[model samples]
Structures are given as structure tokens and as C-alpha cells.
Target chain A: MTSLVADIGGTNTRVALAEGPGLMPDTVRRYRNADHADLTDVLTDYLREAGSPEIAGACAALAGPVRHGRGRLTNLDWTIEEAAIARVSGTPRVKLLNDLAAQGHALDQLAPEALVPVLDGPAQPGATRLVIGIGTGFNAAAVHALPGGLMVGEAEAGQVSLPVADAEALSLAQFLAGADGFAAVEEALSGRGLGRLYDWASAGAGRPGATDARAVMAALDTDPEALRAAETFVRLLGTVAGDLALQHLPYGGIYLIGGMARAVTPHAGPMGFAGTFRRKGRFSALMAEFRVSTVIDDFAALTGCASFLARTE
Target chain B: MTSLVADIGGTNTRVALAEGPGLMPDTVRRYRNADHADLTDVLTDYLREAGSPEIAGACAALAGPVRHGRGRLTNLDWTIEEAAIARVSGTPRVKLLNDLAAQGHALDQLAPEALVPVLDGPAQPGATRLVIGIGTGFNAAAVHALPGGLMVGEAEAGQVSLPVADAEALSLAQFLAGADGFAAVEEALSGRGLGRLYDWASAGAGRPGATDARAVMAALDTDPEALRAAETFVRLLGTVAGDLALQHLPYGGIYLIGGMARAVTPHAGPMGFAGTFRRKGRFSALMAEFRVSTVIDDFAALTGCASFLARTE
Candidate 1:
């Protein structure tokens, strides 16, 4: 059976026809969300282009929370509801899931080569796996292997209070706390978080600049401040990842996804990422027992949506 | 059919005969762990005293990690293997689970009166519930409600780095970081953690003394340092609970269980516990949606083991 699957992000929406639990990369089409009025229009146009192939159902992975079968894109001015999507796409069933949950559903489908191991540990088949998305934002979900099916519980870990251990990092934490008096993990771990870290480093060296995350990463080779900022970002990622590994105990593995993962992956190994992740006080050894990996594919959410649809059917 | 269930703790072993999901309080028995050579000896003694009922199966919750159907008591010189336990108890089957996992299984079995709500939120029938045990040590598990059954993923939350937001808490985090260079949540959140907090508070006041957690709690009315320490304890508890809630997104509820839960429950409301728990920067409202509660029963672990036994069969 063929089904329509879409990953609705703020900037772009990727639509594809899913055959069984897998998706063909060539069939996936990307459309700028700004080009469409809403998800219904987007689906209508995509179906027209695909010659209106009959789909059994449609599922979307939204870049925002899906509440009561409805989801509003976080960065775009469009809301997609299950009934509306089903009506426009001419599908019998429609499902909306948090993007992180979609990525969780794609965990098993990800080819072995698509994953890069940050920490090596024994993988038990029936144990839980965690999917963490670190892009414009940070969120996570634990995928539990169950008798009936996989259950993915979404997490808002980005907003959780950041753990600061180093005295140097304490200054950054205080600065990030600002008026709210709370330094969330996202403040130091997201793309904007990278820029903030660079600003802090530059300010500390009496050379503050308004460089963004991309410019900061580009300057890593020649600029000491940029290098320090990137290092700090990776270390904080380690802290957050370690904390989450403990919180979820995903012995199956912790899989990192999204754009920021690509940015951090290069420096993660050299910047004391795994070391910080394993330094869990007395249970440091136990922390080492959990594996860490990154999902390199950009279409994981689409894959997840397709998988979810197939599993439900 | 009656089944044997036991909760093995650091200092004592609790044994009971469970007819179903609930246990008869009159049938509960406690034994000092030090009095037995091993778990088999302890079980033999417990079964003999229980009039040797015709047990179908047995399940034991151990105060340690269970691996490969075996567990070694964290604080006692006893190793309990599934086969050894089955042999000793003469049960058809035996299971071993981390004590926290057992407590998680007991979440639904707990009577309404056994749970004290600290934060009120709508409880959906099949939402995830989190159980955190803060006793001589700390651990947690997220109980996912599955169509077929419940799935509990045990967490080593205690070993996760402590989240510090304020200057005062940062100082304590640094002090507690010790040689490990990390301040694990358990270092400041467990039973002994209370004493450490009190000690830090006393030393800061230049009136250091050998005061235990019980003594500090007893002097809360008369001692300024004790009051501050207790307040910090509650705030930190709130911080940990809030962080775990974000990590797990347990909209069902966050449940506090164990000895320290009782000690800290009184100060929770007055010491800005929920306030801190809900102070999640942008996701504060989402945090508020999660109900916080403390498990009041002392025998929840035993109940959990019996419940697990029944369900697995």
C-alpha cells in the first residue's frame, strides 16, 4: 500500500510517497513552506504534481507540538490538522506527530552507515533508544521497544536547567541566566547557543562581535575565540547528552539528529564530549555503558512518518 | 494462586505473599539483611516464616542493578540470581528487577490515598508516569502505559550531574563536585545528601558539627542553618523533579517515593518546590501540566514485585 508522508518544518516541507515501512529518497520532494498558504495547499499541489496517486493514508511530522490531532508550525504561519489534511490529500487516515517522535520511529530504519558512534557500548535489542534533535531548537524522545510496538515519549529537554560543572562555565551560566535567573540547556546547546557561546568567549577576550553560529564555526580554524566557543558548545552537548542518557537509560543507544548535530559532530570527539558524558560521578562507568551516535540523514523524519503509518496500518 | 514478593533494600529485606496486585499488610515481614548470608538464605527464612504457602512464582526487587537475571545488593554482601531465588523459594518462576523499576510497576497499584499531590494536573488514563526513589541512593524509571502492558525504563538519575541555577547553588555544586569534578544529583538529593547539605550550610555559618540528616530535620525549628539546608533540599528536589519531568515528559505525573521523600515533603510546598519545578524558561507552562506527587506507602516496592510477577505470567 502506498501512503503520503510529510515532514513539515518551519522553512521547508518534504513530502514523499511511502511504500511499506521504507521511503525511496528519490521520490521525496522538498517544498518551501513560504510558497504555500497552509499544509492543505501544500498537499494539494504535491498531489497534483505526483499525478494524484491514490494514498491509503497521510502522516505528517510537524516541527511543533501536535495537540488533539492538530499542529501549528513553530516558525511558519500555518496550522495542519488531521481532518483537514485527510480531506485535502484524499487519504483515509491522518496522523500528526512531533518531529522528534518521528525521528524516533526512524531509529531502526536508519542504515548502520548513517549513524556515527560517539560512545561505544553493547546494544541490547529490546532496550530503549533515545532520539535527540539539536537544530534551531533542541528536544528529545525515548523510543521504547514494546511487545505490541515502539512507544516514543517526547521530551522538552532543551528547556531543562543546564548543568554547569566547570568554574569557567559557571560564568557563562550566570550570563545566560539573565533576568529569568535560569540557564536552560538550550541556551548553550542550540545553533543560537553556539553564537551565544562565541559572544561570551569574544567578550571575555575584550573583542565582542556580532557573528552568527555559521560564521563562528567557519572561524574555528583561524580564530582562538571561535575555537573555544565551539569547544564549549561540544562540552555542553556532552553534559546534556550524559544527563539525558541517565534520565532515559537508553542502553540501546542515544541517537543525535538535526543540523546542529552535523555542526557539533566534527569537534565532539576532540572537545572532551565523550569524556564529559562518561564523567557521571560514581556511576561514570555505568554512563560509559550506554552508546552515543548521530543520525546523519536529513530525511529521517520522513522515514519515521512512513514507518509510523505502516506500523499503525 | 499466592505468589511470593520481596523488596530487598540496603539494610533490610521485606517479604510478603501477594494474592494478586495488592498484598495483605498482615502478611508482610521484615528481616535485617545482615542476618542472612545471601538472598537464598533470606528467602528461605522468609518463606519458612510465612508458613510455606503454595507459591506459583516469585519476584524480588533489589536495591541494585539487575543484569542477566542476577543482582547483587549494593550495600549488602548478597547476590541474588533468578535461578537461585527460584530454587530457594521453590517457585516455578523468578524475576529480578531494579528496586526503582518495581516501584514504577506499583504506581497504578497504589491507592489514591497513598499518593500526595504536590502539583495538580489533568491525568490522562494512559499517560506516562515517572517514579523516583530517593533513599540511601537515588534512581528513577518512566512507566509507559502500553496497550498490552506497562513498560518501565529504569533511570540512573541520581548519577546525572546536578543542575545549578543560582549563585548559592553553584557554590554548593562546586563544593560537592569533590574529586570527581561533577556534582551528581544524588550527591545533593539522597538521604546522605541531606546531611551533606546541612554540613555545607553549617560550615558556611562557621558552626560545623557532626549532624546527620535526622538531627538537622529535628533542629529545623530552632536552627537557622538547618532551616536553610532543608529549604535548599526542597528546592533542589524541585529542580531534579522538574528536570526529570522535562526529560521524560510524564504528563501523567511525577511520583516521589522512598524515605527521603517523606522528610522533604513537608518543606516542599513552603520552600518554593513547585515554583522551581515550573521555572523552565520557555516550557514552564508545559512543566505545569505535569502533576507532582509523592508516594506515601512504605511497601510500594513489594507491591510492585508482586504486580510484576502477576503481569509477566
Candidate 2:
């Protein structure tokens, strides 16, 4: 049966049609939240443009919490209800999944080329896996293999207090906290967090910060400060990711996703991710059990939604 | 049907009999691990002393990882196998659980007086809960309500890197790291960690350190440095616990267990636990959703085994 799947993030929303467990590549379309008034409008416009093809079921994955058939985007002012989705799709078969959960479910469906290994280890077949996204915001999902289906545990880990061990990192956390006196993990790990790191570097060197995260990443090759900020971001990412690996015990693998992770993946090795990740006091050896990877598939969530619909049905 | 249950730790082993879902308090016996060779001897000794009561099943909970019906004590030289347990209890129905998992299962069975609420909030019944143990070593369990029973996820949380935010705390971590250059959460939050805190305090003030965890806690009333160490321990516990809360998203509550947690529970308020716990930047209000409590029951693991036997039967 033909199904509609949408991956909704804090920044933009991607809509696609799926046949069985496969996402239709050419049918995929992206929509900016700033242009669309609501998810319903985005869905309606997408459906209309695609010759208004009938969809048997619909699944929308959002970058936030989903409870009781509703999804509330964490970094956006959008609340999506299953009923609203049903009305727009002209079908009552609808489901809402946290974006991280979607990514988790799609892990198996992603092509080998879509994933790049950052840290190598044995990936257990059915062991629990973790999906971490660090783009517009940060979050994680623990994928558990259950009796009938997969159970994905959601976490607001990005909102947790920033962990600091190094002196300069501590200063950066303080700089980010400002008067708030509270620097969250998201403050140093997200896309905007990259900008904040760059700003911290500039300020430390007695200069006014002017560039955003995109500009900072683009200037990494030429700009020493940008390279330093990116290096710091990757190093801290390792520390945070290491803590998360312990928290979840996802021995299957740790999959990094979203824009910021991809942007920094190339620099992770040189920036000291492996060193910081495996530096646990007594459990240093245990860290080697978890393999780390970056998921470059943009339509992985769509694949997840399609797979979920097929599995549950 | 009668069942035998044992809660094995690094220091000691607790054996008890359960009739259906109730742990026979009078049948409970404590055995020092040093006195016995392994779990089989302890179980045999316990069964023989308990009048060799015929049991239908047996369950043993260990303070470490359990895999393929085998449990290994993390901080002890002990390995418990299900076959050995069956031979001791003379029952084929035997199961091995991680100590944290046992504690997780016991959360619902704890008596009113056995639990002391530290942070009050609406504990959503049947919602996800967490059990954190800070004793011989640190670990956690996530209690999930499944259709037929509970699914507990084990975590080696104590072995994770110690999170340090305060300047003095960072110094403490560095001190604790010593030449190893890695300070795990267990190194700062466990019973031994308390003693390390005292040692750090003494060294910082140029005083000779002379105390274990028990001696430090005993001197809390008169010794200013002892009091400060205890205070620092509580605050760090809060920070680590808070991180676990976000990692697990336990809306029901965070249950603190083991020796160190109970010892420092009284000073949690004045030591600034709640402040550090709830200081997650923009998610400060969201922190109010998690309730924290200290589990005081010593026989909770026995109850957990009994409950598991009954539920599975």
C-alpha cells in the first residue's frame, strides 16, 4: 500500500511517499517551517503538488516529544495531532514518532554507503542501539528489540547540564551560561552551539564574534580559530557521547545523525573524539565495545516511518 | 510454591526464601563473601541452614552484568551461573538478574517507610522509573512497564566519566584521577568516593588525611572538612543523578539505593543537590517533573526475585 511519511525537524520538514517499506526517492520534497503556517498546510500543499495521490497511511516523525497521538516540536511552535494528519491525508491510519526514534528504526534500512564508521568495534546483531542527533538541537533514542516490535526510549539529554573536566572547556561553558548560570549539553553540541564555540574563541582572542555556525564551518580550513572551535566541539562531543553510551548501554552501536554531526565527522579523529570517549576511569576497556558511526542518509526517517507502518500493520 | 533468592554483592551475600510473592523475613541470612568460596557454597549453606526447605525456583541478583543465565559481581571475585544455582536450590526454574535490575523490580514492592522522598513531584503510575545504586560501585536500572511484566535496562553508570561543574569539584576529580588521568562517576559518588573527597579536602588544606567513608561520615558533626566532603559528595551525586534522569526520562521517579546514597540523603538539601539538579538552562521547569527518593529497604532484591517468580509463574 502507498503510505505518506514526513520527517519534521525544528528547522524544516521533509515529505515523501513510500511503497511498502521503501521511500519513493523522486517523490521526496522539503518545506521550510517559516513558509508553511502549519504541518497540515505543508502536508496539504505536498499532496496537492504530487497530483493528490491517495495514501493508505501516514506517519510524521517530529524533533520533539510525541504523546497520546500528538507531537510537539521541541524547537518550533508546532503541535501535530494524529487527527489532523488523518484529516489531511484522508486516512485514519496515522502515527507520530520522535525524530530520533524514526532514525533509530531506520538504522537497519539505511544503505551501507549512508553510514560512515567513526569508531570501529564489533556490532552485536540484536543488542540495543542508540541514535543521537546534534543539528538544530540535540536528542537521543535507545532502540530496543522487543517481542513484537522495536521499543525506542526517548531522552531530553540535550537539556542536561554541560559536563566539563578540562579548564578551557569549563570556561567555555561559563561563557555560554552568561547570566543564566546554566549551560546545557545543547549549548555546546548543536548547530548554534558551533557558533557559540566560535564566538567563545573570538572573544577569548579579543575580537567581536560575527559569523554563524555555517560560516564558521566553511572557514575551518583557513581560519585557525574556526578550526579550534570545531576541534573543541568534536572533543566535547566525544565526552558527552561517552557518558551517553554508559547511560544507554547500547553495545550494538552508537549512530550519530543530523547536520552538525555530519559537519564535524571528518574532523572527529583529528580532534580527539576516541581518546576522550574511552577515557572512563575503570570502564575504559568497555568503551571499546561500542562502535560509533555517522548516518549521512537524509531520508532515513522516511524509511523508518515506512518500516514502522509495515511492521505494525 | 516456594522459591529461593539471593542478593550477592561485592562485600556480602544475602539469601532468603520466598513463598510465592512474599519474602520470608525469618528465612533471610547474611553471609560474608570472604567466608565462602563462591555463590554455590553460599546458597548451599543458606539452604541447609533454612532446614533444607524444598523450593520450586531460585533467583540470584548480582552487583554486575548478567548474560546467558550467568551473573558476575563487578567489584568482587565471584561468578554465579544459573546451573549452579539450580543445583543448590534443586530447582530448574532459575534466573540471574543484575543487582540494579533487582532493585528496579523492587521499586513497586517497597513499603511506605522504606522510601523517603527527596524531591516531590507527580509520580505518574506505570510510567518509566529509574533505580540508582551507589555502593561498592555505581550503576543504574531503568524500569519499564511491559505488557506481561517489567523490563529493566542495566547501566554501568558509575564507570562513566565524573561530571564536574564547580571549580573545587573539578579539582576533586583531578585529585581522584591521580596518575590514572581518568576519574569515573563511581570514583566521586560511591562509598570509596566519599573517602577520596575527604582526602582531597585534607590535601587542599595541607592536613594529613586519616579516614575511611565511615570515619568521615562519623566526623561530619565536628569536623568542618568532613562536613564539606559530605556536602560535596551530595552535590556531585545530585549532578550525576540529574544527568541520569535526563538520560532515562524517568517520569515516575528516581530511586536512590545502596550505602552511600542513604548515608548522604540527610545532607542532600543543605548541600545544594536540588539546585544543581534543576539548573539545566532552559529546561529548568522540566526538571520539576522528575521526583527523587531514597530506597531504604535492605531486602528489596529478595522481594524483587519473589515478585519475578510469581509474575513469571
Candidate 3:
């Protein structure tokens, strides 16, 4: 039986069909999310172009929080409801999961090449796993092995107060106070966060006008102040991720996805990501047991959507 | 048809027989855990006292981490294995669970009177639940609903980096530089944590003799500085709880269990615990939807151990 899957993102929607488990899509299609009035239009367009195969089950990975069978996209104005989706797609079985949850479902389905090791540790099967996304925004969730299968719990962890350890806390406090006096993890970790960090460092050193993560990266290529800020950002991110790993006891491993993780790969090692991740006092040994990896494939969420549909069916 | 259940703590061991669902304490007995060399001696004593009834299944909840059918008590030097337990109790089936995990299992068995409300929110059945303990030490774990049933993940979150927001960061930075500064969340939130916070605050003010949570609580009864420190501890705890709630999306509810939670209950309402719990930046609405309650019954973990045996059988 064929099943329909869609991963809706801010800029585009990727839709596909799965013939069976681990089956790569015979035909892949993408639609500009803004071009359509709603998700219905996007699905309809995909169906028309793909010869409208009968879907036994349908699942959509949404880029927002899902509650009460509905979701409102964080980056878009679009809202999704189960009934509305079923009506638009003409499918009896429809389910919605957080995009990160879908990514978790796809973890076991990924090829070995899809994962790039960031830290070396044992990956034991049947252990718990943690998935984190740092791009656009910071979010993470824990996935565990349940009695019958696996389950994923989504988290709005980006806004969880960041843990400032040493001199860094003083620097961040001063920087945040200068820029409206309160800064969340997202304010300094996302694409916009990089720019903010750069601006703070530049102004602190009397060199203003630097903006954005890319510009900060450029500045870091030569400027010591920018380098320190970037270093601080990566270290803080690692500490936060380590805390999440401890909270979830993700001995199965930790997977870092999202655009920010990809961009900051170079800085992760130099910024003491490993040291910070394994720095859990007495439980440091347990944290050391957790293997950390970065997901290099951007299409992981799309594949996850397809995989989720296949499993539910 | 009957199974034996035991909840072994550092100080005491409570044992009971499950004639069926609830406890049959007519067939129950209690013993001091320290008096016995191993669990075998305790079981032998209990069985001998209870007329040595044949048991088909056995479950024991230990106040420590369990791995690979073995448990090492955190407070004591006792190490228990399922095989040794089965042999000692003459039971064919034996299962071991973390005391907190067992407490989570017993949630269904808890009567309404067993809980004291801290914050009110909707409780959705089958939603994920988060269990936190703040007593001698701070630890937390999340239970997720899966296809087969519920799975609990163990967390040593007390050792994770502590969340420091605004002035808290400055305090923590200073604390880190002190002799007792490198402490984790447990250092400030547990029974000992309360004492540590008092010590830090007193030292910060150039008066460093406060010791113990009891002393701290007594000083708070009269001294404004002491009260402020206690209030900060509670607020930071609430903030950490809120962080866990957001990370787990614990729609099932947030359960606060431990000696510290009980001790702070009277001061919780007056100290703005509710306000701090719901203070997550953008996810305040989501945080508000979680029901936060403190487990009032001292025997909650014991009851949970009984329930675990009942369900598995």
C-alpha cells in the first residue's frame, strides 16, 4: 500500500510517497510553501503531479507545536487541523507529529553515512536517544524505547534558561543588559543570535556594525573578540545540550541536526563541546557513555515524515 | 497466585504480599535495611514473619540506580541482584526498578488525598509525565506512553549545569569561584542544596556560619537575608522544574516527589513558586498547561513498588 508524507517547513514543503519500509522515493517533489494559500493546496498540487496514488495512511511532520490534533506553524501563519487535512487529502487516516518527533522516528532508518560522529562513545541498542535542532531556533527532545515500541517527547528547550558557568556568565550578562537586558538562548544561538553576539562583542571592543551569524563567522576569521564570542556561543550550546542529555539519560546517543549545528561544526571541537558535554559532576561517567553525532542530511525530516507514515500504517 | 513486593530504603524495608491489586499488609512486614547484611537476610526475615508463603513473582524498588539486573544503593553499600533476590525469596520471577520509576508506576494507585496541589493545569490521559525528586539530592526522570505501555527514563539531572538567569548568573559565577561554588543543581535545590544556598548567601554578605537546611529554614523565620536566600532557592527550583516540564512537554502532569518538596510545601505558595514555574519566556502558555503537585505520602515509593509487581504479573 502507498502512503503520503509531507514535511512542511517555512520556505518549502516536501511531499512524497512510500511503497514500503526503507524504500527511497521513486518521485520526490517540493512546493514553495508561500505560493499556496494553505497546506491543502500544496498536497493537491503534489497529488496532481504524482498521478494521485491512493494513500492508505498519511502523516505530516509540522514545524510547530502540535496539540489537540492541530498545529500552528512557528515560522508561518498557517494552521493545521486533523479534520481539515483529512478533508483536503481525502485520506481517512491522518496523523500529525512535531517535525523533531518525526526526525526521531527516522533515526533508526537512517543509513550509516547519514551520521557524522562528533564524539566517540558506545551506542547501545534499546537505550534512550536525544535529538536536538539548533538552526533557525534551538529545540530538543528525548526518545525512549517503550514496551511495544519507541516514543518521542518534544521540548521547547531553547527558551529554558541557559546555564552560565564561569567568566562567560559575566560576559553574557553584560552583553544582554546592553541589548535590552534580557537574552534567551535563542537570542544568542540562532542565526539572529550570532549577529547579536557579534554586535555585542564589536561594541564592547568599540567596533560596531557587525550583524548576523555569517558576518560573525567572518569577523571570527580575523577578530579575537568575535572569536571569543563565537567560542562562548558554541561552549554554551554544548553545555545546554549536555544538560539535556543528562535530563533524558540518552545513553542510546545524542543526534544534533539543524542548520546551526552544521555551520558550527568547526567551532564545536575548539569550543570544548566534548568537555562541557561530559562535565556532569558525579554522573559524568554516565554522560561519557552517550555517543554524540551530527545529522548531515537536510532531507532527514522529509524522510522522517515518510517513515512515520509507513510505521503508523 | 500471590507475589511479594518490597521497597528497600537506606533506613527501612517495607515488604508486602499482593493477594491481588492492593497491599495485603495482614501479610506485610517491615524490617530495618541496615540490620541485614544483604537483601536475602531481609527477605528471609520478612518471609519467616509472614509464615513463608510461596510466591510466583517478586518486585523490589531500590533507592538507587538499577542496571543489568543489579542495583547499588546510593546511600548504603548494598548491591542487589534479581537472581539473589529470587533465591532468597524462593520466587521464580523477580523485577527491580528505580525507586522514582516505581513511584511513577504507582501514580495510578495513588488516591486523591495522596497529592497536595502546587499548581493547577489540565491532565490529559496518556500524555507524557515528568517525575522530579528533590530531597537528599536532586534527580528527575520522564515517563512516556508507548504502544505497549509506559517507559520511564532515568536521569541524573541534579548534576547538570544549574540554570542561572539575570542576577542568579552573577551569584552562580561568584559561587563557582568559591570553595563550594562548583556545585550542581542538587547543591542548591535538595535538602543539602538549601543549606548550600544559605551558606552562599551568608558568605556573600560576609557572614558565613549558616549550615544545614533546618538552620536555613529557622533563620528564614526571622532574618530577611535568610528568607531571601530560601526564596531564591525555591524560585530557582521552580525555574528548573519549568525547564524540565518544557523539555518533556509533560502534558500528563509534573509530579514533585521527595523530602525537599514536602519541607517547602508550606512556604511554596508564599514564595512565588507558581509564578516562577510559569515564567518560561515564550512557552509560558505551554508551561501553564502542566499540573504541578507534590507527593505528600511518605510511602509513595513503597506503594509504587507494589503497583509495579501487580501490573507486571
Candidate 4:
């Protein structure tokens, strides 16, 4: 019995077919999401190219919340439904899970090359694992290892209002608040958020010329305003990540995923990310016990999606 | 086969006998914790009063973190270990769990009368539930409903740095930098936190006369400074609670359990706790979907301990 799996993101749709447990990909395909009207069209194309093999079950990693068998992408205009996809792919049973949840399910299947350890901790088996992604957007989730495998849960923590501790509050109000007022943490911590931070720092430093995140990073090479902005961005990101680690008590350690984490790897050390993460006062000792690492592999989520379909089926 | 269960808090220790699914209070006893040196003393008294019934298994809910089969009370000097308790009680096996974790395991056994709904949501089965406590200390945990019962995991989220949005940050800094220099969120939000808020507000408003949470609440009956401070405390608490709800995605609902929750029930409404909770920008609609409620019963954790021991045995 073969199972078909798909991971749909804002920019691309990844499709693959699995035959059985620990099975190699029979057919792997990718489609530019902009070219397709919806997931059904891309899935249809995958099925046609793969000769429309009979699939016993199907699972998809969607970039949005799954409720009542349907998910609307946060970054894209695509609305994915299990019934619609099942009909298109001719699969009897289908499951839709958040992409991060699928990433969590795939944690156990990662190869040595797939993982890049950021910190080391007590390697106790069956402990809770916290997975965080700092890519196109910022979000995190924790996976508790049950008797058989792992139970993954949702974390929309990125959307929570950013915490401006003491000195940072002054900077945040001066740099973040706009005419309509500052948005949540994601407004300055996400990929798009970096640009906003850059703009705010530039304006605060009396340089009304700075614009996007790229411009800010480039200016950091020379301009103090850009450097200050970048520094704040990295520091706050680290603080929040540490905050999440404490909130979840991720004894299994913390895994940083997505493109932004990779980009911030160099700054993770110098920008005081580690320092801020470990500064939880009395719980600081407990915080030091956790391991923090960044996952630099782009294909990790795809591999995770494949692993998820295999284990559940 | 009967099991013994105990919920040990700073002020009280509740001991009960679980014959099967129900609790035997005639076999149960409550003791003022201050009267006893440690848990063993209380357990011995309870067992002696109950005719020293042979216990098959024993589980205890401690108002502190459980680590390496031992627990240290957060507010007290008491430290207990499973081995010592097992030896004293003649129980072959003993399990110690965080009070919040134990409360989570007892979710299924709770009767309708046991819960008082503060916010309502869809009755979706199999969804994850979040349990939060804001009393002497603050903490949160998520309970994943598994087959036959619930699986609970501990979260030290309370220790996570409090998010000080805009105005709150200024007030917090003013409060912290004053005479005490206290930085903990629990310093201002717990039973003691309200008092600190009042002190800061009074000082900030140039009135050094008002002190204590109760005094501040009374002053708020007429004083604008006291009212604003009280409102800020509730709003900050609500924001943090909402953040936890989002972080856990407690689609099943958010259960507020602890002494502070009860203390602030009346003020929670007027202080914009609900409004701050539901103000998550794009995710506000999703936040509105969660059911929020305060656990009014003092014996909720005790009942939970009883239910947990019964099921495990």
C-alpha cells in the first residue's frame, strides 16, 4: 500500500510517494505555487506525472491551521481541503497537519546531515522536544514523546505581543510604534519584521533614508543606526526563543528551523542571543541545561513530511 | 486494591484513599502543613487515622517542580523524595508530579459542577486543553487527551520573562528601580504582585502613603492612580494569559486555576482582561474561539490528585 504526501508552502508545493515504512521516494516532484490555482491543480499534476498510482492514504503539511478538514494558507491564497485533495488524488483517507507539526513528527527521522546542533544538553530519551522555525515567519511548537511516538501541538506564540523589558521598552516604543501603532512581536521579529525594525531604527537614529531588512543588514556593515537595529533584532529574537524554551520546559532541547535562523547564525553569538536566552534570573540555571541549535537544511521539512506519512500509515 | 493520594501545598496537605473511581473522605484527612515537619509526618498521621490500610500504589501532587524522584516546595523548606515516602507509608511504588501536572491528569474525572466557565467555546472532542495557575507562583501546562485519559506536560512559562508592552514597561521599570529593584513578573502579578503594583503607582503618582494589594484595591474605589495601577495589572495578566493560550493553541479551552485567579475575578472584567486576551490582531478571531474559565473550587487540585491516583492504579 503506497501513501502520497504533499507539503504545501507559500511559494512551492512538494509532492512525493511512499511505498512502506522507511521507504525511499518513488516519485518526487515540486511545483511553483504561483503557477497553480490551488493545491488540487498541483496535486493533479503530480499524480499525472507519477502515472496516477493508487494511493491508500494521503497526508499534507499545510502552512496554516487545519480545522474541519480544511486549511487556508497564511502566506498564500490557497484553501486546501482533505475531501478536495482526496478526490483529486483518488486517495481514500487523508490527514492535514500544520507544517510545523509535521516537522515535529519527522524529528526522529532526521539524518546526521539534516540536523545542525546549536547547543548540547542531557540526552534523555522520551523527553519533550521543542521545534522552532525563524524563516518567512516566526513560530514554534513542542512535541511530547508518547509511548509509541510523538504528539505535536500548535504554538502561535509569535503572534503574541512582544515583551519589551525595561530598557528595550523605551527603544521599542520609539522604534516600533507608528501612526496606527506597532503590531505584535512578529512585526519586528519575522522576515518582514526585520525590515520594519530597520525602518524604525533608521528613523530613530535620524536617518529617514533606511527602508527594508536587506538595506538595514547592509547598512550594519558601516552605519551605527543599522547595526543598533540589527543588534536589537537578534537580542530580542534570542530572548523570545529562550522565553519559549522556558514556557515549554523543552527538556529535549530546542531546534531552530527556517531560513532566518540560518541567516542569523553568525549574529546568534555576537548579538547576545545566547546571553539573553540564558538570563531568566533564578531559572537561569535551568535555562543553561537546555541545548539550542539551528537547522540549516532546506530539505529538512520535506524529509520530515515524508517521515511523518510513513510512521502514521 | 486501593491507592493513597496526597496533594501537598504550602498551607495545607490533603490526603485521600481511592478504593476505585471515587474518593473515600472518611478515609481522607486534611492537615495544616505548618503543623508537620515534612510530607512523611503528614502521611503517617493520615495512614494512622485511616487504620493503616495497605496501599497498592501512591501518587502525590506537590506544589513545586518534581525532579529526579524528589520535590522541593517552592514557598517552604520541605523537600520530599519518593523513596522516603514509600518507606514511611509502606507503599511499594510512589510517584510525585507537579501540582499543575496532576491537575491536568484529573481533567477527565472533573464533574460539570467542578468547572465554572468564564469564557465558552465549541465543544470539540480530542482537542488539547491548557491549565494555568496564578497563585503564590505562576505556571502553565498542556494536557493532550489520549485514549482513555489525558497526558499532561509541565511548562515553566510563568518564569519566562513577562512581556511588558508600551506603558506597562515604563511602570514596571519605575516599580523595579525604586526601593526593591525586583524584576520578577510574579513580584507584581501574584497575591504580592498586586501590592507591588500599588506601591509603584502610589510612588509614581507622588503619594507614598498607599501600600499592599488590598489597600490598593480599596484606594481604587476612588483614587485614579490606584485604579489605573490595578487595571494595568489585570491587563498585563490577561495579555500573558492570552499569550499562553496562543502558545498552547488550547482549542479545547484555557482553564485558569489558582488563588490569584479567584482574587481578581471581579477586577478581571472591569480591567480589560478579556479585551486584552482577545486583542491578538489577525489571530484575535482564533483567540475568541477559546473557552476561558477560572477554577473556583479550592479542592480542584485535591480532587484531581484523587482521580489521578485512581486511574493510574
Docking class of 1: medium
Distance (Å) between predicted and true CA of A138, model 1? 0.6
- In angstroms, the error of model 1 at B199 is 1.5
Q: Which regions in candidate 2 have their CA more than 4 angstroms from the true location?
A: A178-180, B178-180
Which residue pairs collide in model 1, if any? Answer: none
Q: DockQ each candidate and list the results.
A: 0.70, 0.67, 0.49, 0.52
**Per-prediction TM-score to the true structure, in the order listed:** 0.97, 0.97, 0.94, 0.92
Looking at model 2 chain A, report the run of 10 residues with the lowest lDDT sum. A175-184
Candidate 4 segments whose C-alpha is farther than 4 A from its true place: A19-27, A51-56, A171-182, A209-219, B25-28, B177-182, B209-229
RMSD of each: 1.6, 1.6, 2.5, 2.8
| Residue-wise C-alpha lDDT for candidate 2, range B1-313, written one tens digit per residue | 9999989888888999898889989988999999989999998888788789888999888888899998777678887899988887889999998878888888778889999888988899989999989887788888999887898986778877777676776788788884557778888788888888898888888997967898999998898889889988887887788888888889989999998888888888888889878877777788899999999998998899888888898
Q: What lDDT score is found at residue A17 in candidate 3?
A: 80
lDDT at position B29, candidate 2: 90
Kindly provide the TM-score of model 1 when superposed on the true structure, using C-alpha atoms: 0.97
- Candidate 3 lDDT by residue in tens digits, B27-118: 65778876788788888888888788888788899878899999988888888899998897787789988888987887877889988998
- TM-score of model 1's chain A: 0.98
lDDT over C-alpha atoms for residue A119 of model 2: 100
Model 1, residue A254: C-alpha shift (Å): 1.7
Per-residue lDDT of A141-251 in model 1, one digit per residue for the tens?
889887666888877788888888877888999878846687888888888888899889999999966678899899998999999999988888888888888888888
- Pick the winner on lDDT between candidates 1 and 3: 1
Q: What's the lDDT for all of these models?
A: 0.86, 0.87, 0.78, 0.76
